[model samples]
Target: MWDLAGTLPLPLGVLDREGSTVIVGLNGLRLLRDGAWKRARAEAGA
Candidate 1:
């Protein structure tokens, strides 16, 4: 994967404003959970 440090982050409304209701509902939670899981796994591995 590339760093792309200069890349700008996408806004929350970047996705569907009406559609993807289910995805919108779970996206943030899933992202946070995955982040925590990744950190936990990385620390455990280290």
Candidate 2:
């Protein structure tokens, strides 16, 4: 999820099961949710 509101840029880091670290982005989530994320998020927010 998007954390720390307003302008500027946000940087984040995470580790996986194997201890492999990687970066995440909104575009990735968009593509991952291309099937139904939009409606789901709207409903959740509503």
Candidate 3:
């Protein structure tokens, strides 16, 4: 997840492993919901 998040065009926010939550910033969340995560993973060949 961290690896995929790193590929995002915008900055992601605090990732809390203990809570198993990814607190993404507003823009990052929007992008992720818009399929940025998949695109990033594909682009990275992951």
Which digits, one per residue and each the tens of the lDDT, describe model 1 over residues 1-46? 1225634345534443445876777876775777788998999999
Per-residue error for 12 in candidate 3, Å, reads 28
Winner on lDDT between 1 and 3 is 1
TM-score of every model? 0.30, 0.26, 0.31
Tens digit of lDDT per residue, candidate 2, span 1-46? Answer: 2333543333332233223322345445666765677888888999
TM-score of predicted model 2?
0.26
Candidate 3, pairs of clashing residues: none
Instruction: Write the number of the candidate with greater TM-score, choosing between 1 and 2.
Output: 1
Would you give me the overall lDDT of model 3? 0.56
Stretches of model 1 off by over 4 angstroms after superposition:
1-32
Q: Residue 41 of candidate 1: its Cα lDDT?
A: 92
Ranking by lDDT: 1, 3, 2
Cα lDDT listed for each candidate:
0.64, 0.50, 0.56
Backbone collision tally, model 2: 0
Across 27-46, the per-residue lDDT of candidate 3 in tens digits comes to 45677574787887899996
